[model samples]
Target: MRVMVALIATSATYLVMQVLRDEPEIALEMGGTYEDMLLQSTAHFSPLIPGHIWFRVPKTDARLRFIDTQYGFITPAARFFTVSFNDNVITNIRMSPQIEPLLLDDVLKVVLDLQDQWRANGWTVMYPRDNPPFADTPEWRAKLRDVNKGGITFWQAGDKYQVFLDMGRFRDSKRPNEERYLITLALAKPWLPTQVE
Candidate 1:
């Protein structure tokens, strides 16, 4: 039984590797519609963990529909993902190592690995001390303000992509007095829809 499970995992990994190798632009492209996003994610990820499915959550806001999943793995490897789309385009994606205890070092390692992936793909990854790479607009200012408050320690800017890594701890509302750490890697398209404002 153990051998069978290992075989399945290996076969799935190989299939995913083949897909990624065939599609160099597997990194979710900016401006892709929600359907496009879903198709791409399903095609790229469903093989990693059998039986896991991607689905949309009920719409809380008219402009955005939250799509979430617990797939087996992704580059830099994450299990949980929440994606937000507005006006048919993906506005945000948040990924985390959902198997928790959410240690600081573990989260940082994932963030760094993801940064390396972006760097390899031509993005200019930046640390917080560096000058912000985004255009200084009201929208960006507001966005950065939120990022700053959220503990953004790493970021990057590309022609169309903006990525940020946030790491912080907060008191868990459900378990009073207990601290919980959140490590989120977020991706957004630079020219986001005004509906997000």
Candidate 2:
């Protein structure tokens, strides 16, 4: 039985190496760093883990961010994940921009984990810092103050990591209020090839 298991494992390893040699890589022009790829993509949730099936981890760190909105950044090698809350909505833990939709009533363990990590790292986590839900500028407040209507985007601009939160009524609704929040963080892609620190 031991020999049989070893044989299976060896054959599987060989098969994966063979496939990787033949697979086409995702190559984005402009040399986009990790943050750029995640910001522009609306791909489904893909948790980073062993023997997992989801979005492929990029070959370079430029395809991931060191920090995202208040959700914080998932270490390239970290396996655990948390929920995202915006206006009482739970964002996807398996992929990006794909909200669980029904899990808004559930507690956001992911957000809390992120908050804990941030506090451990000494970052000030707060909301309503930049743009209001319905307006782009700091001076304009949305007439409709409902918190639950919005979208989220992320990126790394210059020396800071940024999360762009946009809020509005769901499609076909009659509401004049909209909201947006852009959060900036102090972080960067780790230069080490195998380290997420």
Candidate 3:
């Protein structure tokens, strides 16, 4: 009887693991892909293949925390869910389909001019191998190794919200140049006015 009970417990545990493995990381589109009026470009580290991403679960009530969402050691540019190894304040990085990369820098400069930009939002630039709690991690230092090569770097200075600039080996698949820009605005806070709310 004890042997049968043990076997049942083991089988239940295995089945539960399989089901949890399929849970979405970073919510539906927050991972990076964004949809806009003109164009619909996927965000960085998206289109992740199943079985590549994993979320840490502490208890039944704990929220799903995607691999990238939590700071840890991981590989760069992996096709897995956490492949991009992104660590930034603006978690999601979706852009409209009609957007163009030509004026990316120009637009970024203008947004940076905002004084309260960083206060309203936060962003930290990172490479594919970044290990963060912040931008000053070893992963960020690694980017300097090939400064000339260029890579994706997140920026919140551009606007009140965080933005990411693609300046690296590869460009976004949906967007043309690797110079694609990303902006992830936070949902309105409880106190913030909604157009005179």
Q: Write the per-residue lDDT of candidate 1 for residues 58-177, one digit (tens) a residue.
A: 121111122222111244334455555555554667665343534444544555565555555555645434423333356543443352343454443534555566655645566555
- For model 2, the stretches where C-alpha displacement exceeds 4 angstroms are 1-72, 75-99, 105-107, 126-159, 165-197
The TM-score leader among the candidates is 1
TM-scores, each model vs. reference: 0.48, 0.26, 0.21
Off by over 4 Å in 3: 1-93, 96-98, 103-116, 119-148, 154-165, 168-197
* Superior candidate under TM-score, 1 versus 2: 1
Residue 37 displacement (Å), model 1: 2.5
Write one digit per residue (lDDT tens) for candidate 3, span 127-171. 324421223345533452343643343333222234343322224
Candidate 1, superposed: residue stretches over 4 Å from native: 1-27, 43-80, 127-151, 170-180, 191-197
User: 1 or 3: which has the higher TM-score?
Assistant: 1
Alpha-carbon shift of residue 108 in model 3 (angstroms): 4.6
TM-score leaderboard ranking: 1, 2, 3
Root-mean-square deviation per candidate: 12.1, 15.9, 20.3
The 0-to-1 C-alpha lDDT of every candidate, in the order given, reads: 0.47, 0.32, 0.31
TM-score of model number 3: 0.21
